[model samples]
Target: MILETRGIGKRFGSVLALRDVSMGVRAGEVTCVLGDNGAGKSTLIKILAGVHQHDAGTLLVDGREVRLTGPRDALDRGIATVYQDLAMIPLMSVWRNFFLGSEPRKGLAFDVARARRVAREELKAMGIDIRDVDQPVGTLSGGERQSVAIARAVHFGARVLILDEPTSALGVKQAGVVLRYIARARDRGLGVVFITHNPHHAYPVGDRFLLLNRGAGMGEYGKADITPQELTSLMSGGAELEELAHELRRE
Candidate 1:
């Protein structure tokens, strides 16, 4: 396993955000974390991304216990998270956005040429083809922007990629494009943690599923262990859904 969380948990004042949520991601596999709103998915991602520390649990990198105090800590350990907002400046060029905080420098000066060359090469390595690295980030399509973010994370040497609701706002075609890049990332031998509520989106690319309900674990199952229909039904609260159907039945 590249990343492992043992009995991970978190709390906020009177509410319990997570409990005994254990998960693991290995190279060349996508672990999809599925849940609806307030299901503690965000909290769990924060923990894994080093945005928040687990109140209780063990975070292990390469099977060795480690503490993630902040985002830098996680990044140093080869973990990178791409949130829904993507963190790219609209007016900035693609290469600049790619190296925003960690820009390549030449003797205390920003190496604009080097950054552009490296960015183009890195994106090409991920099979992403954008017309120009000099174009402003806002000029790229939504799917393209998402792909750039993924490529940036991969280029930065992130052994584990944590994506939060990456496909939520995209159209079917755009979502399909992003999913392709996700598969590409997995193929590159990186552990991928894909978080989303859409069963359709998760089903196609996920190797393992960790279902969350009201801040608790429903269960973890391999792709071969459960059907997509079963996963969707369970995610929608099967018994509760049955009750709801009966309640809404016309006489």
Candidate 2:
């Protein structure tokens, strides 16, 4: 396993947001973290990404226990997180966004040529078909933007990529496009922690699934051990969903 959490728990003053949650992401595999709103999905990923510290249990990277100081600490250890907001300037060119903040320097000047070339090459390598790296990022489709972010993280040598709700705002076609790039990243040997509430989106590419409900572990299973239908049935209020469906059915 490249990243693993054992009995991880977190608290926010009077609220215990997460408890006894354990999950792991292996190299070249996708670990899908599924949950509804307020399921502690955010809290768990925040802990993993070093946005928040865990109050209990252990976080392990490469088989060693760690207490991450912050997001910078996680990044230095090859753990890169791409939050839902993506941290990109919409008006900036794709290449500029790719090398933002970490731009290469050539004698006190930004290496514009090197940045553009590397961005194009890396996107091509990831099988992303962006028309031009010089185009503004805001003009690209949502899926295209997500792909570029994934490619950037991979290019920067991320051993483990934690993506938070990457597909939530996308339509079916666009969501599928993002899922393809996610699989491409997994193929390149990055342990991907894909956080989402949709079982339909996750079942296709996930090697392992961790279901969260009300800040606790619903269950964790390898793909072979669980079916997509079963997964959807395990979410918070899953059983209640069936009852609601019955009431709405036409006779």
Candidate 3:
């Protein structure tokens, strides 16, 4: 396993954000974290990404206990997170944004030629097609932007890619595009932690499903053990969904 949490818990003042959450992400597999708003999904990912420290339980990286000091610490350990907003400059060129902070250096200056070539080659290697590397990132579609972010993460030696709601703002076709890239990433042997509220999106590409409600785990299930319908019900709170369904039924 690349990343695992055992009985992890976190609290903010009087509120408990997460409690007894346990999950593992393995190489070449997609571990999908499913939950609605305020389900402790964000808190969990933040802990994984090294943005927040867990107040309780153990966090293991490659079977070794480790405490992350910050995001840089997480990156040093090969855990990179691509958030929903993507953290890319919209007006910058695609290649520039790809190598935003970690540009190759030639002498005392940034190596523009090397950066552009490497960026283009990496994107193509990941099956991402871009007509021009000079085009502004804002010009690309949402899925394309997400693809770029994923490609960037892979190129930077990320062993565990934690994607935060990548398809949340995308349309059907655009979301499909991102999902294909996610599958490609998984096939290439990187452990992926896919966070999403939509079970439909997660069900297609996920190997394992972890459902959360309020601030605790509903359960974790393998693909063979849970159908898409069942996963959806679990994410929405099965009883709550049943009550809503009954309310909508005619008298």
lDDT of 2 at 22: 93
lDDT of each: 0.94, 0.93, 0.95
* lDDT (tens digit, per residue) of candidate 3 on 75-126: 9999999999999999999999999999899999999999999999999999
Give the lowest summed-lDDT range of ten residues in model 3.
Answer: 232-241
TM-score of candidate 1 against the unseen true structure: 0.95
Lowest lDDT 10-mer window, candidate 1? 242-251
Best lDDT among the predictions, by candidate number: 3
Predicted candidate 1 versus true structure: per-residue lDDT over 1-251, tens digit per residue:
99998888998888899998988999999999999999999999999988888888888999999878999999999999999999999899999999999989899999988999999999999999999999999999999999999999999999999999999999999999999999999999999999999999999999999999888888899999999999899888886988888989953
lDDT of 1 at 197: 96
Local lDDT at 15 for model 1: 83
Q: After superposition, which runs of candidate 1 have C-alpha atoms over 4 Å from their true positions?
A: 243-251
RMSD of each: 1.9, 2.8, 2.1
